[model samples]
Target chain A: MSNALSVKNLNVSYLGNVALTNVSFQVDEGALVGIIGPNGAGKSTLIKAMMGLIPSETGKVEILGKPIRKTRKEIAYVPQRNDIDWDFPIHVIDAVMIGTYPHLGLFKRPKKQEREWAYQCLERVGMQDYGKRQIGELSGGQQQRVFLARALAQNADIFFLDEPFVGVDVSSENTIMQILKELQKEGKTTLVVHHDLSKANVYFDELILLNKELIAKGEVTDVLEVNTIQKAYGNPLAFMKNEIGVKQA
Target chain B: MNFIEAIIHYEFLQKALITSVMVGIICGVIGCFIILRGMALMGDAISHAVLPGVAISYMLGINFFFGAVITGVLTAIGIGFVSQNSRLKNDTAIGILFTFAFAAGIILITFMKSSTDLYHILFGNVLAVRPSDMWVTLVIGILVIAGVYFFYKELLVTSFDPTMASAYGLSTKLVHYLLMTMLTMVTVASLQTVGIVLVVAMLITPAATAYLLTDRLWVMIYLASGFGVVASVIGLYFSFMYNLSSGATIVLVSTLLFITVFLFSPRHGFIRKVIKSRKRASLAN
Candidate 1:
């Protein structure tokens, strides 16, 4: 019923070129929200700015009615898969353990309790068996699942995933979506930067359409309208009509 | 005297052995993070940049460690500033700044007309390592080792994924600068054993060898340090026996170890991949 994340007048630029402009939206607690846009639509940039991963030119991000800095521990973010160096020497479980870092802080080591919780998080994603495998050794879907397990281990109130399904397989995608739905049922807010428009309506309780700015933000049916999709994507998607039940104008 | 007897009887040999081993351990530890972060070139840059600092310290009648660390950190910041401010890539920045610093060092040393000290500084003579320098290396070894152990999590996260680290409110830049400071100290400590030119070898080769041998980071750290010690001990023996340069010999030994592991490591080795694919081809028949 209450807003879990609120971004007001967000503006971001890359090398003096605008990446995102005047983007603003609010995500309610216990909702799975999908951000959909064309390529280079600044979907990832929007999420990064909200998480304060990259500097935003002008914006205000509040999580749980507090500034992001004060509520950092309550937010979990899984960056795009390509942003990671797959060959880095780390075990699946150890990578998942990094999710506990926000809770562990500087000097404290992860105790047995934290380790068990990390393992449990892995179990939640059905990746408990792959704990000892090298992260790079896994298939793309398994790698994404492992990352999702790590974010689950964070125990954060809100989750943001950037293009999680980009290279993922169907089974892992289903597994990830199921886990995300479970998180929503547990009253956690989740915002996913999704590339597949076909699954957008099914996966998210709400949708935020973006194209360097906020085009639409509301229920799936409302935001997936033909006019809004054309505005954000710059073309009428003939395939989207059947996909989302969008009546052609 | 034989090597063991020399080590037992001569205090200079004892100092050299201890100092070289300490350098080995710390370089091995720090080098794991360095290579993992793909900053091996940065390692090389910091090591060379210390030359001007060493020259300045000699002129000032002070310990070169202080001067070397200051310059190393400065070079790091300078590289960062250049690459961030300009269109030049990170390697370009490193190359520009380190060469300038190294050239400045050569000119300073030339002005001092101390070719003998320059030879030892350029090509380290661990045999001539002083007791005070030995103590400095030991202290630095402890500090570097302790710093890594205490900040292992932070380093792991930042090196593995900076975006996640920053999102978690861990200051990735702070960790980077902190690692650079530790690297400067390690380079300064290694000067009497490996010298600036060869120190990056000690930092990278042993860790890379360990990388081929393990998938887990902690295992790699331990194995890398173990390889570093083995190379130091054997290299010192060979250098002492053959009347060769200690720094060059040590670097060569680490390189040999890397080659051996590259060929034979069980999981990620060249030979193993060849054998497995050959077996798979035969199985198809």
Candidate 2:
């Protein structure tokens, strides 16, 4: 497969707690990869480690065939719902504008073009009317959409979404999946820490199963077997992932 | 209020007004972040920590503002670094630093044999504020507000969704430190009159009350500044008329506003409204 992202021997920890260890995986360009694992299995940590948000003990993460540190312009992120304080005072448009911060560089603020692009991103997410609204007033699904809009505005070649589908209705999910598929066509790869095996066939082309380390990774058709699922969530015979995992049925 | 008479007769009041406005705008700008991140109490801790810096600086015969600024920045950085590095809860860290700093300040004050301009430094004689300090606050406020607005997008996204922000290659830590630095500067600038003890009220109350009113950051900034201006005028009058401590009175007045909004604000308080709304919906249905 055409490679868009590559990780090797990745290890990350927080406050002395080991979250991910010796993790390695790859994402093909234009591929929609779903990351599946049990709660605290290092799905979120893996993404954070890639972005250098969490200090990685040992690892190399390359995005678009370059190290993540230098290739930031080509990547974007969508955090979980609980990761943000909804009570924060900001408009949806302002939230979307953050996706362009790196592009603006330090000390320089978002300009008019950036503002318009943020507005356009909100429109793409079906939140045009909500651009001026406070972020807290929106529903959970609406908030998720706003975050998606932010990622869209980033205009990156790759996107890292923690969980972009919780509280979303079926129609909204379809809309988001459509956008993801469209992004693939434009050579924009996406990796989602997704939960909801019910729609794995429709939403993901590849699956990365991790539990402290990579349990499995490859096309969904081969990697999502009953045994693999069991091993990925070995704590219980059947247990879902944690809040860090995206619920995307 | 004639032009010539206004300049000379009301010169002291004029200087006080100008100083208060500058402080209000700075607080409003930086307070926006403090309220958004739930770090309201942390502002209080850092402002109080400046007390010791002031004492030390006075003892060393340096500009008091120099000590105040040094302590404010150091306190902010220490809080940021420790919180980021360790498992210590924010409230505990703030409490530990704030109490010790204030205590050290009081000890220094006790031992000083020379006349101490403690009141001038703490409560602030607005009439005595030099033009240079006024200019510094104005420039700092402008720069800070510009930074806040410029990085508006990054700040908003990071504050709202750190996981997403980090994933997008936006360093939430960088934005966090930026916001804290701005808050520290604003706290230092506002120290002119609000004093260390209650300067935090100036930082938190206006924004908190504005939070009860609106959800948008732009609206929040405007409303918070408006509330700050109102509280300042009212607090000053109350202080001047009744001979109360200006700083303490201003803080109390702000607290009163916060309580009133907490109980009666229409959108924020859902628990009380739920019962009423349920009854109304049932009657209508």
DockQ of 2: 0.55
Rate residue A124 of model 1 by lDDT: 90
Which prediction has the highest TM-score against the true structure? 1
- Residue A207 in model 2: shift from native, Å? 1.1
lDDT value for model 1 = 0.92
DockQ of each: 0.89, 0.55
| Every model's TM-score on chain B | 0.98, 0.82
Candidate 1 Cα outliers beyond 4 Å, as residue runs = B282-285
Residue-pair clash count for candidate 1: 0
In terms of lDDT, the best-performing candidate is 1
Question: Native contacts recovered, in order, as a fraction for each?
Answer: 0.91, 0.80
The sequence of per-residue lDDT tens digits that candidate 2 reaches over residues A168-203 is 777777778888888989888999987656566668
| Model 2 / residue B227 / CA error / Å | 1.5
* CA error at residue A95 for candidate 2, angstroms: 2.1
Clashing pairs in 1: none
